[model samples]
Target: MRAFSGSRLAELCLVLLACWLCPGSALAETRVALVVGNGAYTSTAQLPNPSHDAEDVAASLKRSGFEVLQGINLRQAEMQDLTIRFARAASRADVAMFYYSGHAMQYNGVNYLMPIDAMLTDEADLKRFVRVDDIVNDLQQAKNLRILVLDSCRDNPLAETLKRSAGATRAASIGRGLSKVEAPRGTIVSFSTQSGQVAADGTGRNSPYTTAFLKHIEQPHEIGDVFRDISSDVYDSSGKTQLPELSLSIIGKFYLNGQVAMTVAPTAPQAAPQPDPCAAAEAHWKAAESIGNVSAFEDHLARFSSCSFANLAKARIEGLKQKTVLAPAADGARASGTKAFDGNYWDVTLNCPASGKAQGFTRALAATVTNGVFHAEGQNPGGSNRLEIDGQIPADGKTTLSARGTTGASAYTLNNLAPGSPYAFTIDAQFERSRGSGKRNEARACNLVFVKR
Candidate 1:
């Protein structure tokens, strides 16, 4: 055969990679992107870089095989129309991406992306802006992979003005930067900065976060890796102050440049086994334990819902909530002699007796108890099991406990019962918990013993 030229060989390699990555349907799927940049504001100080950033990103996306819809200096009505049109286009596409560069903020836990014409003088003015959730909800109707990139975390000088002009009611709602969002399945959301953090609009034509993203997005790498690279680049460029945040729930692998992943042949039969997700989940769970926050545990469960540690993560989250519930009372000066919930971890022993088609479940667990609520989880024969015991200590000295436990398909709920102590609670009901779609049923009894560690 004649020697192939270097460029010719590279082209052939790329074609082969495409075939491997897409199998037989690469040409059949469409990729669409919508880019919006709002810089020219009539009501506040004009943002100079967003329009340019959008244009550059639009061009870059077009080069990357996306049918790009780009708009600049969009008003509220124009923004709404564009999103509608974009969503329609995305409905027919295999991959949909939304890139927005502008001023955005959170008011009362709801995120609103600002338009060029927005004045936002009062809380009622929020109706004139575009809610980020609306766009997300509209895009959720799309068939395949969705990507949302927001470079809209600039601090608004107008927010303070609005707060000063409007009153405490509206002021309390206005907050710096965007709130965290839970991306739906098959979607990836990228924020220029962490939730509630402001992003720097660079001195140049683009924001620091967008600049780093543009630099590496065209490279032949997995999409996740591309974001990781963006985060690293921005952190370094911004003196480690402006770190990007990502919410990813992508079901399958996707490469930006359609590169085929390298695969090695297995050396033995056992080597071909699928990787255990529990390993990764447990590692993240351990990492989150050090942080000891609700979001940390919630993140683990979101990524690995079916993992072995899922119930434990859920219980941890509930335990944190219990602590939060009791914290306010302590801060408000509760009754004298009432001790606050101890912060120490507790070892839990649960006993769920078999009754009325439900199997017996018993396991040792670890958890944290706050006040009269105990949240714990453990692995059983079928899967992970969780137990939540809530007690209400009334002022009249009569205390009642409610316990709920779930394992696989079996669930047990014990209504108001006289519980002995905040450290331990038991349910010895006469009937078993209901099962199946519809039928009369009774809840089974459960015993939970907690020991501080």
Candidate 2:
């Protein structure tokens, strides 16, 4: 026989080791994978690493005994068809995986994967992209293990356009990268970087995350160990900037190299250790900070009332409340000199008393006037209710502030308007140096009190 090279000898040894450890195991377990790489975008900047990442990862999976379904620079329709076929193949597999490398984003707490042909100029255009939740549901059909790897978190130019077209309430919900997702039982979801943070496309042929992943995936270590190693490698290689993250709910031990036998007998499985509360709370705070909305901050406060960031969360809520917009100033007022209330912060309290078929509600909003412009926005925590106030303060300190927003719950609106119904009203009032008051003479009695803060 011809003499084998050093690398070839090592590969032969690994094959013999697998055979010696578990006979016929390679043929026993069925593995399937769906790999997609979408670059060459039509309306946005094209990525450079996804296609090479997919090709290399597919080759590696194939050598590891996976039946891989691979696609490159795929459009929306082509991607959907591949996903359908992959779902059918995964239904009969022992281990199934889905990997994508391209553009991805989150809106309204839902994650979306972008295709090459996508032109996401409006929020409604999101319907044309692929929802990550749908793909995860498809991956859940596998019998044993389900893995999802996304190396698509590079900076996306499409997100800015979507935000510009979305409503103020919905625009605040759009976020960077992918949101954190809870993995289903027996599944693991991995991202190139932590939630709300962008990942780097490497200077090499593949992304930093994918390059690190391909390095350790062929090792005979357990799956968790493999990911931990990948995370460490990425953290070190990316100058400590890109840290990989995973949501894992997998049970028992699994090795990619099919090294299943242990020298000792298996014992009862142990429960996973509890995560540190402060660390978890900080993670939640980071995600909320990225969104920069009152609802997101309020949600953080609701979950972590006593965490270290509780006061910070409250302050964020107040700041976001101050950023809302009222109606525009009249052209004559806009041309006037500096108004009396040019630099002032107002503590705005809105109280709507109970009326027939409508429940009562109260909110404290922080408003500010800069260069004679008065603008503020407020939203009900944990609900869809929103209030936008915008107008310019004239030299007389008297003007009508117009407010408009969609209703939340039916019980919270005047006359029990349906949720999501649009409504508008005006506040007629006058402001002094330190105190001001306004009243809405609508069907329901609502009053506003503004005190200089």
Candidate 3:
């Protein structure tokens, strides 16, 4: 090696001292990411772009000096395990990110990300799906910056099934797209489109949002500016139908390209905006209309007595009360002349067989037919599970009964389903005056037997 000049040696020594004082100065700061793309759905139509989007994003992140955990066509259990590992890695990282492109939805205002194998037959299936909030929470543990990107606003194929099973009142809470979420301080949350709107899966190899995102993510600009460019690009390219939206609470500039040093400074948080009264009333009115129940209308009237919907609420209450009175009279008339199935008391037994990854169990219930209508409600003692069965028995004594309930105990459920997940299925049954037998019509194998009590 050639001898260095005095000036050059002194400069090199100073550089070494700086590196010794600040260990990270000599090395790249730690950046970690979790990227997931689900395209091969088992129950719904497969998406065309998610797997490609994930691969492209992962490659870009790796080029940007990020350690990326990438997954494609992930199942529920695999997704959960990967997230747990990613969360652990994020806790040690300076900048952490999560990107997902898949089938996602909002149910009762909560956003859920669906895995490839997810069969979201009802709202209860949400338990098996990942919540967007959970991913945000994971990123929140990162040291400096957190970024969440969701290119999951494609039209959901499972929404109709959930709506049909949830009943009218609950169905209204199932929104068309992912719900709006407020970012925590020092974090940014991005959506492919505005809340309650759908986005197109591009005809190309990636989604429109991902296509725009990849174009600007490595453009040597601040992350905020990059996302703004992405939003604008998506808007212009989609003929103004898709407008990307973001909730950003980042305090200072963050550059993804590593071309600039990250700068974060403490800032006072802004006060939350006060809710608009008329808007709140309108939302309440919508809920009441969806419920179409006397108590729901009465509650709305109590809350907004002078609002514009007050008169409508009162009218609905009156109509509901009249219907209630008429219903009892009609039932009494039918009861006076006992029908074939009327006044029949039955003990109901439900038997579920063991399936893959799920344990089997049995349940018992009591039912009575009144005015040719069968009704039963059952609850597990000291447990959260509850079931309701109801339907009309025609003269032929064969009819389909509806069964819906909140699930309990993961071990007892199919696929080890999360507790409190909602499930609904139909039971095809033929009944005599005192005996009945039925089979559940769904993915699982379950049979019901009824005997006179």
Number of clashing pairs per prediction, in order = 4, 6, 1
Candidate 1 global CA lDDT score: 0.68
Query: How much lDDT does each candidate structure score?
Result: 0.68, 0.78, 0.79
Residue pairs in collision within model 1: 432-442, 432-443, 433-443, 433-444
RMSD of each: 13.4, 13.6, 13.8
Which candidate has the highest lDDT of all? 3
Instruction: State the weakest 10-residue window (summed lDDT) of model 2.
Output: 324-333
Q: What lDDT tens digits, residue by residue, belong to model 1 across residues 297-340? A: 99988998886456556666876899899877753553432233
lDDT of 2 by residue, 226-281 (tens): 77677767877887667776666677778778554423323877688798565477
lDDT of 3 by residue, 247-349 (tens): 5666667877634232333387768889856547655765665455688899998998876566556655765788688977665654543367776567899
RMSD of 2: 13.6
Question: Which of 1 and 3 is ahead in TM-score?
Answer: 1
TM-score of each: 0.59, 0.57, 0.55
Better TM-score candidate (2, 3): 2
Best by TM-score: 1
